[model samples]
Target: MDEDLMRALREDRGVKATALAKALGLSRVGIYEAVKRGEIQATRIGRRIVIPAHVARRLLGIEMEAA
Candidate 1:
């Protein structure tokens, strides 16, 4: 996976699952499963689900950005 794409996904608060899947060369179902299994963190936002950038970096074993 491209580190830039990973970083982008990990820094963009509003990055969607579909976009992440495309960027990571992963299926959307795979991303969903990861969320379901708590391998990644996500929260419901109205009718949409969102994953935090910090959580994404953590899941990738990368250092989180400074808040």
Candidate 2:
């Protein structure tokens, strides 16, 4: 993996589901549905759904800690 990607992954605290879906060219509803079906990793912050950075790291096979 690229060092810049690794660095960015480590620095990400949380990624909005909508933004993630948009970035991946997926539907927001599909993203939410995937979350509901446990196909994707996510967490709820009171009422907001957030895709945690750790999930992204794990998916990309880039385990890292923020400097």
Clashes of each: 0, 0
lDDT of 2 by residue, 6-61 (tens): 45466777767776666567898988998999988999998888888777656555
For model 1, what is the C-alpha lDDT against the true structure?
0.69
Q: Model 2 misses residue 24 by how many Å? A: 0.6
Clashing pairs in 1: none
TM-scores, one per candidate = 0.61, 0.66
Ten residues in sequence with the least summed lDDT for candidate 1: 58-67
RMSD of 1: 3.7
